[model samples]
Target: MKLGELFQEIPMERVHRYAPERSLDLITNESKACRPGALYVAIPGQRVDGHWFLKEVLERGAEAAIVQHIDESLPLCQIEVPNSRRAWSALSAVYYGHPSRGMMVYGITATNGKTTISFMLDSILRGAHHKPGLIGTVKIRLGDELLAAQMTTPEAFVLQRYFREMADHGLDSCVMEVSSSALEQDRAADVAFDVVSFNNFSREHIDQHGSLEAYWQAKASLITQASSKSVAVINLDDARIRTLQGQSAASFLTYGIASKDADLLAVDLQVSGPTVSFTLLIPRPVYLAGVDRTVPAGAWPMKVGSPGQHTVANALACCAMALAGGIKPMDLAPGLLAYGGVERRFEVLYHGPFTILDDHFANQSNIRTTLSSLSQMDYNKLHICYAIRGNRGVIVNRENVAAMAPFFKDLRVGRFIATQTLGEVTEKDVVHDEERAAFLDEAVRCGLAPELIPPLDEAIEAVLDAADSGDLILLAGCQGMDLGAGKILTLLAQRHPEQKAKILWPLNDRVCGQTIPHPPNKKETQQ
Candidate 1:
C-alpha cells in the first residue's frame, strides 16, 4: 500500500509527504523492533519523545519517520503533520488495508460494563460463526491468541497494527471498548465502525478531561465518527444518552428497560441465582436481506451468565448491536447462554459457608450497581472490603463515596470497611488525606459504621474474620484489588481445601497471563 493512497481522505496540507516508491515491511515504535523499510512514528509521550530516538530508529533500518516536526539532520524520510497522533491513526488504517471495513466493528464507551459487553459480543459472534476480535482493558484477542493491553485503549499506531494483524488472522468482526481519552486524542480517528454503542457515562477522568461535559463530548465523538449507514445504539435508560443522540449521524437504534419507545427493549425480566433471564422485544421484523430473520417483533428468551440487573441491561445492549449488524435473534440465545461473563465484574470467588464476590467497581455508578446486585442475592450479612485510588479526580471520588454510602446504609451487612489503596500520600505538594477522610465520614454518616485501614491486606483480614457462614465477603476496587483477591483466594483454598471445589473463578474462562505492552524505555511497575 502506498502512503499517498492512505492519506487520501486527509487534506493535502495534513499530508506533508508520501513515499510511494518505498516499500515498508512493518510499522513499529521500539527501535529494536523496526525492520528495514519500516515506518517509524515519533510519538511525543509523557516520559520520552520518539524524536529523541530518531537516530536509533534510522540506525535499526526504518525507512521513514512520521512526526509532528521535522529533524532535517536525520537521514530518514520525514513526513510532518499538524498532529502526529491523527497522522499515525490515518497511516495505520491504510497500512492495515482498512481491516475494520471488512468486518462489523462495535465501539462501546462507558465508565463501567464495557468489558462485559465486549465479551458478550464476542461469544455471540462466535456462536453465529463470525470470528470476532476484542481489544479492551483486560486484553486484546486476534482469534485464539491473547495480547496483554496496558491501557483500556492503545495509541493510534499500535491499535491500527493490531487491526491489521486481526485481519490477517481471519477475524470477521471486532469489538472494542473505546475510552474517552482515546477518542479525545484521535486514537481511533481512522477506523470506521459498523455500530457504535454508548453505555452510561459518569464523572470520571476529570483530572485529564477537566470537566464532566468535556468527558461526555469525548465519548460522544465515537457516535459522531460512525457513517450514516452505521447504527448508533444508545442506552435510553441513561440520562446522558440524550446528549449523545443529538451528536450522532448514524441510523438510531435505542435499548432500555424503562423506555417503551426503544427499538429493542427487555420485558418480563426474571432474576434467579447466578442466572437472569429476560424477554427481548423488537419493534419489527429484522431482515438481513439475504441473511437469516431475527426476532419477528416478539419476545425471545435471553439468559445472561451473571446474576445482576445491570447484566440484563448489558445483554440488551449486545442484542441491539448484533441486531443492528444483521445478526439473527435466534442465534443470540445460544451464544448468550454460553457466555460465562468477563472476569472481575461481580465474580464469585468462594461460596461455601460464606460467599466471596471479587467485583471491580472503580467508579461511582459501578459501585452503586455492584452493591445493588449484591442486595438482590440472598446473604445473611454483606461484608464489603473496598479500596479507592488516591490519584482519582476529586469529583469522581466524592460521587463514588456518596453513591456507595446509600447502598451501604441499605445493606443489612455486618461490616463495611472503606480503605485507601495507596498509603496516604500527604505532603506539601499533594494533600489527599482530607479526601480520604471525607470518604470515610460520608460512609459512616450513611448509617453504616465505616472504618479506614491503612493497607488493603489488613482491611481484607479484618473483614473476613467478621464474616460467618451465609455471609458475603466482597472485595471491590479499581486498582490492584486483584492482587489482594488472588492472595485471599489462595489463603481460603489452603484453609479449606475441601471448599476449593466450591470456589469459582469469575467468568469461568481462563486467560493466559501475559505482561502488558509498554512504550520504549519505560519500566513496568505493579499498581
Candidate 2:
C-alpha cells in the first residue's frame, strides 16, 4: 500500500517529511521486528521507551517512524504525534483495513466471568447463523482453529491483524474478552464495537492497576467509549457497573439475577449434579432502550452444560446482547443448549473414582466461586492444592490465601501442599518474599496448616498419597498451575498405563513434567 492510503483513515499530527507515493511493507512498535520498508512506531512503554530505540530501528531497516518527539538528525521520515498508543491503534486498523467496523463486535469486561461469557456468546452467535471468532485469556479462535493466547487481550497491532483474518474467513460477528490492562494501555483504543457489556467487578490486579478505582476506570472505558448507536448490556445487581451508566452514550440493556428491575432476569437457579437450570424471565415493561422494550411476558426453562449459578448469570448477559442484536427469547434456546464450558474455568480433568478439577484462581472472587461450586458437588473427601503465585506482589497473595482459608477450614484436610516452579519461570514470574509471607501469615491466621513444597513432582505425590478413591483433587493457581494437570496425568500414566486414554484435563499448550526446569538466578527472590 502507498503511504497516502495508510494515513487516509486517521489524521496525523504533523508529517515532518512527506512521501505519499512511497510504498510501505509493514508497521511495528518493536525495533527488533522492523524489516526493510517498515514504518516503526515509537510507543512509550513502562520499562523501555520506543523513542530511545528510534536510532536502532532506523539503523536496521525502519524507513518511517511515528514518535511523540521530533528527531532531526536521524536519517528517516518522522511523524510526530501527542499520543502514539492511540495513533498506533488507528494506524493498525488502517493498515489492516478497518475490519471490526463492519461486523457486530461484542466486548465484555469484568474481574471474572469474561471467559465463560465469551464461550456462551460465541455459542449464541453461532445459533443466529453468524460465523464468529473469540479472543480472550483462555484462547483465540477463528472458526475451528484454537490458538494459545499470550494475554487476555493482545496488543492493538495483533488485534487488528486477527480481525482482518476473521473478516477474511467470512466471520460476521465476534465476541471477545476485553481486559482492564488492555483497556488501560489503549490496546483496543480504536476498536468500535456494536455492543459492550460489563459483568461483575471485584478487587483484582490492584498491584498492577495501583488502585481499585483505577482498575474500574480501565474496565468502564469500554462501555463509555461506545457510540450512541451501540448497546451497553450491564449487570443490574452490580453497583459498580450500574454507576457507569451515565458515562456511556450508548443505549443500555440491563440483566441481572437478584435485581428485579433487570430487563432480562434469570430466576429459580438450581445446580443439579453437573448441570445448572434456571427460568429466564423477560418480563413485560422490559426497559431496554433500543431493543423491543416490551418483551413477551414468559418464563422459559434454561439449562446449561456448565455447572454453577454464576454461569447462568453469564448466559443472561449473552441473552441481553443477543436480544439487543434482534434475537427473540424463543430463538435463544438452541444456543444456550449448544454451549458447554470454557477450558480450566471449572473443567473436570479426571472422572474416575477420584475426580480432579483444574481452575486458574487468581483473585478472591474466582477462588470463592470455585470453592462455592465445590461445596455443592457430591464428594467424599476434598483435597486442595495451590501453586505459589509469583510476581503479583503481597496484596494479591494475601487476598488469595484469605479466600482459600474458609475452604481449608471447611474441608479439614490434614494438610495442603503448595509448590513453586523452582525458578522455572521468566523474570516477570519470580516469587517475592513478601508475597510468600502474606500467604503463610493468612494460612496461620485462619487455623490452617500448609506445607511448602518445591519441584511440583513431589507435591503431586504428597497430594495423591493422602487422597482416597472418592476424593476430589483441585489443582489451582495461575501461571504455576498451568502444567499441574498434565503432570498429574503423566504420573497416572506411569502407574496405570492402561487408563492413560481415559484421563481428562484442560487442553492447553503447557509442557509436561518431563520438560527441564530453568536454572535458578541469584538475583531472583525464590520462595
Clashing pairs in 1: none
State every prediction's TM-score relative to the real structure: 0.85, 0.92
Where's the lowest-lDDT run of ten residues in candidate 1?
A: 518-527
Against the unseen true structure, what C-alpha lDDT does each candidate score? 0.75, 0.79
Q: Distance from true position, residue 176, model 2, in Å?
A: 0.7
TM-score, structure 1 vs. true: 0.85
Model 1 stretches astray by more than 4 angstroms: 1-63, 71-76, 285-296, 419-449, 501-527
Predicted candidate 2 versus true structure: per-residue lDDT over 32-100, tens digit per residue: 877666788998877789999888887886668889987888777888888888888888888878899
Candidate 2 residue runs with Cα over 4 Å from true position: 285-297, 504-527
